[model samples]
Target: MKFLLTSGGISNDSIRNALVDLLGKPISESSALYIPTALYANPNGPAMAARLIRGETNTAPFPDGFTSMCELGWKSLGVLELTALPSIDEKCWLPLVKETDALLVEGGDPLYLCYWMRQSGLADLLPELGRETVYVGLSAGSMVMAPSIGEDFVGWKPPTGGDRTLGLVDFAMCPHLDHHDMPDNSMANAEKWAAGMPVPAYLIDDQTAIQVVDGVVDVISEGHWKLFTQE
Candidate 1:
């Protein structure tokens, strides 16, 4: 699988170019399914989540301010909404996933998103998607792809869901590193958190991305990032 995991979603030209490249085509020719499942998370869940709710997350068409990412100077973007996993069937979202050229997962609450991703069966279905489809993630969107969601970074703990992610990547990512937008996210905090994780942990800022092509990892960024592991 291929991924363009950004801290703040397409922040600059470099990130945009990478995303377009990952799409294997111009943004104009490709279509994307914007899954804002993370935004739909309970706002009161975590500290960073609360700040997110107050920030760009409240924006329309995408609570996480998807205008820049979706606009991509390209084709149209579609929104996928599912309030309750059990209430909705696969037919409602599967067909849309099949037609899109990419999947744009927005940021919010990782725990909240995971619950629905699994409950709706999308989690299982995601691995089956064709290699041609790009998996673009922003903030919590990117974090959920890791083996587990570390609460120390965002403090957004699930009321009931487990920390285990889709495990698409072996490393746990702490997005928006040293970002003033979210005060809770700082270099000091992230480094401290990364030290304790079982797997490698990457702290990436808004201008940075953790790009994964087939299993190889690359840190693409215009800002700061750190990869911490037990030596």
Candidate 2:
């Protein structure tokens, strides 16, 4: 499977160019699977996020031109609002993932999102999706694609309990690059995490992304993306 993982959305023109380089020629259509439920805790957050996802918000949003990717054919999907567990499989889960070309998960609280992913059986369902779909995880989305999550602000931190992640991707991903909102010394902490690790690691920024195709991993863009490789 081909994966395009990013720290966050791209708003810079140069970054946009870089993304097109990574994505290669646009397919006839690409479906965006937006998991707004992952960001549903705040009353206004989900709705507010929709506009941003729909390209109706954000001062310097991911550029108006990219909308053509959606307009010309890319179909954006995160339309259902789910709150209950049973509602997941029946009402929102199955249909949302049915015919997707790519699953684009936006950045949100990884904790809550991961919780929902487990509860909703998405963790189990993911590999099945891999049979045909390319999973594009951004920020919190990307972090959950790993075996275990690093300490991150937007996602849930395990409380007295531990659950190994879905383990689809062999590496752990940390988002936000050198941003102050994260650890005081981000690279130092990342290095510490990698000290005894056996697989490659990646610390990404909003403008950066990495594409994992077949078994080869390549730097798709580095505007703000950095790969720790050993952590």
Candidate 3:
């Protein structure tokens, strides 16, 4: 599966273009699944999820001040709540996932999202997806793919201890870098956070994204970002 991991959702033209390249078709022709399970672990999560589904951009938390993921026009968009999947038969949802062009995952709490992904059997299915499927992730959605999120970003802890995540990727990420709303997200704090990480980490602003095709990873950014290797 191809990955379009963003600190913020397709906030700029460059990121959108990269998404199109991944899709190999116009946005209008693509079908996507919006996973808002991560948002439920956050404060006002339900309201935020509603706003995303409705495609409302007003008072959006993103640095770009734009609707993060769900707003983009697509031929079809459906909500695949991870929490609900465990109760249903796999045959009901597995085909939908395999058939979709993309999965648009929202942000909130990475740990919570990670837990549900595992519980819902989605994590195990990821490796089986075809190359044509793009995974578009925003904030926590993107963070969940890393080896770990570090203690600084931990919120809803998993039942099993530790900051470890899916480890789908080799590195960690400190997203929303230097955003005014998140005062603790300064470069200094990011540096300190990276110090405890075993793998390299990317400090990325909202206008930045990490694109992974096969195993080749590339940074796609219109804003500032930095990559810190373990010392």
Candidate 4:
């Protein structure tokens, strides 16, 4: 399985071009799959919506975002609604992902996303997907792939308690490294968090990506890609 870790959304032309260069073809050639953990535009919506008596917008417009990602040349197959799966049967999911060529995980709160991933069986099934196809991960998507989410950026507060991730990748990744919009301490905090894991951590700046193919990870980018592996 191959993995692409981007610092942020594919909103920039350079980043998009870099993705094409790394993926080895246009997204149409790849079976694009997008995963969303949080979709609301409003930052405070989740907690606020939970308290509303009725008609609260618990779920945001996910398809719109999916379409946007596709416009960038991604063949977005579906957004795995981690929170909405218990009502469905499991036999229906594996085949869907197994057939895809690539899987994209969009950005959001890693902690909150991880919370839902555990609630659903998707976390357990991701490694299987990895072994079979390519995995493209953006912000939160990159974070969850790691052993733990880093504190380099703002994170979500769980409704109640903390949640553990599926532990697919050995290291934690902090996407959007050196993004002008992020606070200066983001990388430092992430590095500190990773120190305890005793595993390598990466700070990937925008327009940069880490490509993992057949278990061999190579840094591919047009900019700085920092790696912190404690020997």
Candidate 5:
């Protein structure tokens, strides 16, 4: 599986280059299927980011959206709101997903995203499609891919059902650490959070991302992040 797990969306030249290179094709030749379902449950955010995830759209109140990709100098041909897809009919959404070179998952509520992923059946299709495409995850998008989104994991409470993550990654991620814009997150809080986690945790900020290609893991960022664990 090739994944660019970022605290924020692709925000720098290095991250964009890595995604393009991972696709093994120039951005012009590649297409993406933008998935913004995580925003569906946010109280203050938009119900849908934009009808189209393209260069000329406004993200509005949402922290990230099509405009995030545009700002990073990247582009995509397909844009989808996972919330809009018919949960019972995979046929309605599968083709576009298969046609894309990348799948960009947005940030917000991790459990909410997970619930829809399972409901839409994308959760099952993902393991197979992931082998052939780049999975770009931002914040909550990155958190859901982990084995579990436990207590204090990713700076949020676990969903009502407990650790309901996709289990794609071995560790949990607590993103937005010490981010000046996110006042509640800090290194001190991260340290306290890490000490109680059952597994290793990654504390990342907006400029930081955890890039996992195949089985190799690397920390890529213009800012600082830390690996915290009871181990």
Candidate 6:
């Protein structure tokens, strides 16, 4: 599966272009699934989830250039709540996933998202997805793709009790770098966070995103980003 791991949602033209390239079609012509399960694990999660699904943008305290994932105007957009999948039959949702052009996962808690992805069977099903299917992730959604989110980003602990994630990609990420809303995400802190990571890591602002296709990784940014490799 193709990956468009982003610090923010589709916030800039470059990121949008990368997403379209991954889709191999226009956004208006494609179908997508919005996975907002991660949001539920955050503070005021339910309210935030509602706003995100409703495509409400420019809300206060969300950083200057925050973008909503669902407002992109797709041919069709459906919500695939990972938390709800476990209670339902796989046959009912697996086909929906296979048919969608992309999965637009929202930000919240990375570990929480990882936990649900495993429990909902999505983690196990990822490798079987078609190569053309794009996985668009925002913040924690993107972080969950890494081998580990590092201890600093851990919020919701899974039963397994570790910062480990899906490991879909080789590197970990620190999103919203230097954004005033998140003082803890400053570069110095990101550098400290990267120092403890066993793999390479990225420190990206809202305008940046990392694109991975067929195992090749590229930085698609309208703002700034830094890739740190361990010594």
lDDT of 3 by residue, 79-123 (tens): 999999999999989999999999999999999999999999999
Give candidate 4's TM-score: 0.73
What does candidate 1's lDDT look like per residue over 164-217, in tens digits? 777888899988777655667788888778887779999888788988888899
Q: List TM-scores for all candidates, in order.
A: 0.84, 0.73, 0.98, 0.73, 0.85, 0.98
Candidate 3 residue 164 Cα shift, in angstroms, is 1.0
Error of 5 at 79 (Å): 2.4
Candidate 5 similarity to native, TM-score? 0.85
Tens-place lDDT per residue, model 2, 1-231, is 456666764434554554455445454445656565555554466564666555664322233322311222353444433346456446545766756666666556666667777776766677666545666666666766677665434334546445345566788776666665555437776566555444667766665666676757766554555456642
Task: Provide the global lDDT of candidate 4 against the true structure.
Answer: 0.61
True-structure RMSD, every candidate: 4.3, 4.5, 1.0, 6.4, 3.3, 1.0
Q: How well does candidate 1 score on lDDT at residue 30? A: 89
**Better TM-score candidate (2, 6):** 6
Model 5 alpha-carbon miss at residue 41, Å: 1.0
lDDT of 6 at 82: 96
The digit string of per-residue lDDT tens for model 4 on 118-199 reads: 7777777766664547677766767777765644433566666443444677766766665555666367765665575546
lDDT of 1: 0.74
* Count: clashes, candidate 6: 0
TM-score of 3: 0.98
Return the clash pairs for model 3, or none: none
Q: Which residue pairs in model 6 clash with each other?
A: none
